[model samples]
Target: MLYFVYTADRPGSSALREELVEAHWAYMDGFEFHARGPTLSDDGETATGSLHIVDLPSDGAARAFVTEEPNWRAGVYAAMQIFRFEDLVGRTMWEFPGPEGERFLVTGAAGEPVGDGVIVHGRLRGLDDGAVHGFAACVQAPDADAAARTVRDGRDLTVRPWCFGGRR
Candidate 1:
């Protein structure tokens, strides 16, 4: 199964995140990742969180990944949301055809299934347990509005400026 691990860093934890980068990378090397990167600020320089799409065995495996991750273990993340994901595009970020100008994480309870321009798309896991809930996506778009338009389903549509994550 594929799991999307969205990790939001604690405020003012950049220094701690930087300090654990090596350990984090080394730990992540053990998994087969679909797409991974840090969610960025509007300026595209400051990282607000980390997004990782990984293929694991079960929901327990997904939880184990987060619990053992260096950054998560070191108290870098203020919150973490894990979801069961589907690869609508069926490709990784490296294979995305869009120009790397600006990107956004547009997610909500999807009413209609997404068709195109979706770099990554999947369903969000329930907070109570591993039950599947609404859908989500990470898209490359010109702006937040455009990104939100890509997934025209569900209430409380949130559009956050994002970028390609992970080391080049």
Candidate 2:
């Protein structure tokens, strides 16, 4: 199964995060990911949180991945959101090809987007109950409005300007 893991670093934990980045990356190297990256502050420099879409065996494995992550285990994260995800795009974010300006993380009660500029997106479900809950997407667009337009099924949605979390 695929799990969507989102984590936020506690305030002023950048130094600790930097100190343990390698350990975090090394731990992540053990998994197969559909998408992974850090969510940034408005300036696109400071990391506020992270997003990971990983394929694992079960919900317990997903929880373990979050709990055992180097940064999360080291007290870097202030909050975490883990959801069972169904990949609608069927591709990793690394394969995104165009309209290169700004990006956003749009997640909430939405799914089945029929538009372009979606890097990676999917339906979000409760890991425990296995019920459909919401959706998440990494979008590339001119602005937040355009990004929001890409996922038409959302009503209550959050569109956060985001940076893809990996090598260029």
Candidate 3:
């Protein structure tokens, strides 16, 4: 099963996040990830949240993965969401033919998946109902405005700058 796991950090957990960064990576190293990154503050210095599309064995496993995450365990996360995700882009972020520009995570409303500068795109579905509820995508463009326009046609759309996260 695939899942979209995302989190919003507590108001002032930056230090805790920094302290657990290594542990976070160590834990994530065990997962099969389609995409992973930290959503950031507009200026790009502070991490606001995290986003990852992972392939796991079951819903229970996915939930456990989220709860056991280093950040979650350390109480750095304020809010979190896990969804049954359908990976529309079948490749990892490392293989993305990303355009030259900033990266943004655009989410809200489901529609036809676009290509171009897509790093990873997927359908966000209800965990229990299994019905697609929205769209989540990582895209590269000149700016957030361009990235938002890139994934045209959506409701409640939001664009957040996403800082690359992986063993690079």
lDDT (C-alpha, whole model) for all candidates: 0.79, 0.85, 0.87
Q: List the residue pairs that clash in candidate 3.
A: none
* Each prediction's TM-score versus the true structure: 0.88, 0.92, 0.95
Ranking 1 against 3 by lDDT, winner = 3
Off by over 4 Å in 2: none
- Write the residue-wise lDDT of candidate 2 on 26-66 in tens digits: 89888888888888887788888899999999988999999
Give me the overall lDDT of model 2: 0.85
Q: Write candidate 1's Cα lDDT for 1-168 as tens digits.
A: 888888999999999999998999889888887778888777777789998889999888999999999999899999998888866667877777777667777767654335456777777775347576777677877788777777654577877777776664
Between which residue pairs do clashes occur in model 2?
A: 37-165
Weakest ten-residue segment in model 2 by summed lDDT: 108-117
What would the TM-score be for candidate 2 when compared with the true structure?
0.92
Candidate 3: stretches off by over 4 Å: 113-115
